[model samples]
Target: MGDVGSVGLGSLGHPLLGAVVSLASGGGVLLSGRLSLATHEWLADHAVHGVMLLPGTAFVELVVRAGDQVGCGRVEELVIEAPLIVPEKGGVHLQVEVGEADASGFREVSVYSREEADGDGAAWVRHAHGVLGSAVPSSETQYDFGVWPPVGAELVDVSGEYVRAAENGLEYGPVFQGLRRAWRRDGEVFAEVGLPEGERERAGQFGLHPALFDAALHALGVSGALAGGSGSLLPFSWRGFALEAVGATSLRVRLASVGAGSDAVSVLVGDESGRGVASVESLVLRPVDADQLNAVGGAARDGLFRVEWVDAPGAVAAGGEVASRTEVVRVVSEGPDVVGEVYGRVLEVLERVRAWVADEDLAGERLVVVTRGAVDAGDGVEDMAGAAVWGLVRSAQSENPGRLVLVDTDDVEGVGGVLPGVLALGEEQVVVRSGVVRVPRLGRVRVSGEVSGGFGSGAVLVTGGTGVLGGVVSRHLVVRHGVSRLVLLSRRGAEAEGAAELRAELEGAGAEVVIAACDAADGEALAGVLSGLPEGFALSGVVHAAGVLDDGLLTSLTRERVEPVLRAKVDAAWNLHELTAGMDLSAFVLFSSATGVLGGAGQSNYAAANVFLDGLASWRRAQGCRVCRWRGVCGPRPVA
Candidate 1:
C-alpha cells in the first residue's frame, strides 16, 4: 500500500495516462489521472444493476500502460477489490501505482480512486491490485491457430451473448457486447472478439487498448464458468495476467480449463497471425449476488427503516422472554375509532424488530404474527388488522426463504397453550384454543385439478388488471379459459404508464379489453362500475389483483404510510367481495401474495392487505361460493 515513485508524464502519448508520478529503483513507474463521465462518456453506459461502473477493461488498460513505462511488457495479474464507481456530476481522481521490481523482474501494480473534495478531505479507495512482470522471449511452439477454425471445434452462435449475460444478471449494454464468434473444441473454448467499429481506431493509442482487451475477455463467454445460465460472475483475481504484444484490434482467444483442484482458468490472447499477445496464467472469477448488489450499489436507498427479518427462538413457555429479534406482531384490540393509532403502534414496533434482525441469522428464525383475537372463521369481517399482518408478512416470507408463522390467540401473555408447536416454525398458521394449537393445512394440491369451469364465453371483470401480473392473468383467461369479454379496472386503467401497450396486446390477442379508471377501494365507486357493466356481459368471473406498496419496518409504519397501502388492498378486496357475492360467478379469484402467509420485513401494511384477501376469500367460500386464493409472491426484492 506504499506510495509509488513520483515522476513526470510529458513523454507518454495516451490521453488516459494523464501524468507520470515517479520511477522506483527497480524501474517501476507510477501514473495518475482525473477520470469522469465527462472525459469518457462511454463508461457511463456500462452498468451492473442500475449502478454505472468502469468496465474491467479499464483495469487491464492501466496495468498495460504501467507495463510500458516500467520497461516491462508483461502484466502478471490484477485482483479487483472494490469497483470504481463514477459519480453523477464530477469525475474520480485516480492513482495507478506500480511497485519496485523483483529479481525475476516482476512489479506489483495497483489502482485507487477518490472523489475530489476541497483539499485533503477525500479518502482514496483502492479498487484493484496485482503484479507486472517482464516478458522473456520464448521460442516454444505457439498453438497452430493458423488453419481456419480448429479441426475438432464445434461452431456455436454467439449473436445473443449479451442477452444471455443479462439472464445471468450481467447487464452488458451495447458498448460491452464484444463477443463476435465462439467455438468449443476438445476441452478448449476458442473465439474471435472485436471492439465496436466506432472505437476500433482509438484502440492503438494506449499501451494496451481497452476495447480490444475487453473483447479478449469477452471471448470467455464460451467458458464453462457461465454455462450454468444462472447468476452473474465478475473477474475477481488473476495470479499471472502477463501481456506480450502491444496492440491488437481483434483478438483470437483460446480459453482452456484448469486441473480439477485449481480455482484458476488458463487463457491465452493472441492475434490472427498466431502470435501471442497477452496471457491470463491463472484468473479467478467471483460470483455476485443480484439482490445484495442492488441494495448497496450507487446512492443509498432512502427510507427510515433498515431492518432485516430475523427468525424466532424455539418454542418457549408462555410468559417466558421471547427473542427480541423475532418478528412478533402482538395484535391488540383497536377501538373502532382508533384504527389509525393502532396501525401507528404496529409500525413502530416492527421497525425495531427489522433493525434488530439486521445482524442476526434468519435461516431458522420464525416470524410469529400473534393476533390477540379469535381467528376469523369466515362467518363475518373481524380482526381486519390481524388479517392485514398475515398478508404483509406472508409476502415478505416468500422473498426471505419463507420465514413467516401466523398465530391467533385471545391470550397474548399466556401463550403456554401455543408455545410448543408455534415456536417450532413448522406450521403456516395456527390458532390457540383451550391450551391446544390448531394448525391449518392446505387441503390439497389444487394445481391441474379439475376446476369448476363454465365462464367459457362471457365478460369477466378484473380489478387491478393494468398491473404486470394482472396483465399476465388476463391473457391466460382469454387464451386458455375461453373468456370472450373482459373488464380491466385500475385507478389509472388506460392511463397507467403501460396500460395502452397492455390494451393493444390483449386486444390484438382477440378478447375485448376495457380500461376502467375507478378506485377499487371506494365502495361506492366499485359498486357503480359493477352495476354499469355493458349489455351482454354476464360478469361470471371476478379477479381481484389490485394492491399498493408503502414499505417500512414495523417501527416506521405511520398512519400516513399505512392507510394508502391498506386502502388499495383491504378496502379494494372487500368491495370486490361484496359486489360479486350475489352474482352467479364461476370464479372469484383473489390475488393474494405469499407475504400474507410469510410476512415481509418493511411491508407491514402490504402484508396486511394481502392477508385481507385470504380472509375474504375464505369468507366467500363459507357462503357456498367458489373462490380461489392465489397465494402469489413476486420475485425477491432486497431486504430492508
Candidate 2:
C-alpha cells in the first residue's frame, strides 16, 4: 500500500507488528538488560507477541559497528523499517549489516500464543469454503424478478420476439434460470417461448398484448441504459411508426437518443430486421423520471396547447344602440335601388354568419376573431363593422360560450403592430386525435360519426364489444353505419357495472344498444348469441377486438398461459365466420398487432396469438368473406 493505504490502516491493529517484536524482547536477561523500568512496563502494556534477532553471519551485518547497541539500532530498525528487509542467501538480511561480533550472537525467531497462532481467526471460513465449492447464483436474483420457465427446459416457438423475451425466463421462475434460455443477436435480445399447436382447434392467432408492448419497452430501456436517461417514455412516440402493423415470430427493438435541449427527443425503433420495423420519437419536455416513464402518455398528460388564427372581416356586429339610432338616406334611380339591394345582401351575410356560429359545439369555450378595414361613411363602414363584431360574438358564444375571447383589431393596434388579414390568438388546446386519449378509460373507445343512408335497421354483433375497443367499434357501427341495434359480446356477460356504463355512453351517443354477456372465446356461447338475435333482423357486420397477452420465455411458459389468448382472438374470429355463414354482412374487421410482424422480447405468447389472427384474416379473405384486418401496435395515441 502507498500513502493512502497507510493512512487508511493507521488505526487498524496489524498482526505482523506484534509477531515480529515478540521474537526480539522475549527473554528475562535481555528484557532486563535492554529496557528501563518505565520502558519495560510500556512493553508489557503493548504486549509485543513476536520479534526477530539477526546474527552477522546469517544476514544482519554490513552496517552497524561490533559494539553498537541492539536496543537502539536493531530494535528500532525492525519496528520502523522492517518492510525494507530483503531475502538473502541462506536467510533474510537487513539492508545494513552490523559488526561481526554482534552478528554471531544475534538470533532470528518468531513468537506466538494460542490466540495469535492463526493470525486472524476464521470468522468467514465456512462461507468462503461454500462459495468455492458451490455454483454462484445469478446477479438477476438481487432483485425479486423471475423468468417464465424453469431453466434447462426446451423452449416453444410462439409468435414474436417480445413474447419470447419477456416470458422465456423473466417471469416463470428465478431470474438466473430464465436468462439462460434467452439469446442475444446483434445488439438486440430474443427469447423463445412455447406454443401448443396440438391445441390448434381451440387456439387462434397470437396478437401483441398491451402488457407485451409495455414489457418490450422495458426491455429496450434495460438494453440501452435509457432507464436512467433524461427522457421518459422516450421510445413511445418515435419507434411505433416502423412497428406499425408488423407481426412476426420474434420482435427486435433498437434505441437511439439524440438532440439536446429542454425538449430533446429520444428515438427508438422496433423490428425483426437489423433495420427497424417501427420507430418512435418522444419529445422530452423535462428530465426523465420513473413516474414519467410509467405514465400512459409520457409527458403529454399536461395537455397539448396550440394556436389558431381565424380571419374575419365582416363577422362582428355593432351594439343595439348603433343599429337602432343610425339612419341614412339612399339615392334611388331604378325599380330596385342599389342601396336597398346592398342592405339586403349585408343582412343575408350577417344571418349566415350567425347560423354558423350557433351550430358550433365549443363546449362553452370562446374564441377571438379580429377584423381590419378602413371604412368610409358612404360605404356603410359603421354597419359593416357592427355586422362583423356581431358575427364574431355569435361564433364564439355558440362554440363554447366564454371559452373563446373575442378581441377587436382596433384594440390590438395600440399594443402591437398588426398586419392586414392577420389575427393571433394566444394559445388554444385541441383534442387528441387518436390512441389512448381518444379511448378515455381502459377497455373503451370513444367513437363519433354521422349516420347516413345505408342498410335498413338490424343488430350489429361486435365480438369483444364489452371491451373498450369493441365498445367503440360498436358505437361507430351504430351511429355511422346506421345499424339500428347492437349486440355486444365479451368473455363475460355485460352484467357488470362497467357494462351498464358502456350502455349509457352508447345510448347517449344516440345508439339503440343491447348488451350480451357471453364468452367471445367460447365458440358455443358466441354461436348461441348469434342464434338468439331478434328474428328476421339482418346482421350488419362484426368487429373482432378482444384479445389477451401472455408474456414469457418459451422455455418457461406453459400450455395454459399461451392458449387462452390465442383461442380468444383467433377462435372467436373463426367462430364468427362460421356463425355468420351465408348471412348478409357488410364488413368483417379483425384486429391484429404489429408484434406479429416485428417480434417483441418477452412477448412470444402474445405475438404468436396476433400472428394467428393475421393468418386467419388472410384465410377468411381467400374464402370470399369481406374481411379486413387492422394490424398495429396500438398504445396511447388516439385513433383517427
The TM-scores, one per candidate, come to: 0.45, 0.29
Worst 10 residues of 2 by lDDT: 124-133
In model 1, the runs with Cα more than 4 Å from the true position are: 1-11, 23-28, 102-104, 117-120, 139-141, 223-230, 261-263, 291-640
Candidate 1, residues 315-349: lDDT per residue as tens digits?
43444455654556676656653234335534554
List clash counts for every candidate, in order.
40, 124
**C-alpha lDDT score of every prediction, in listed order:** 0.64, 0.35
Winning model by TM-score? 1
For 244-326, candidate 2 gives per-residue lDDT tens digits of 33233233433333322112223332323333323333311122233322331212222222222222333222222212211
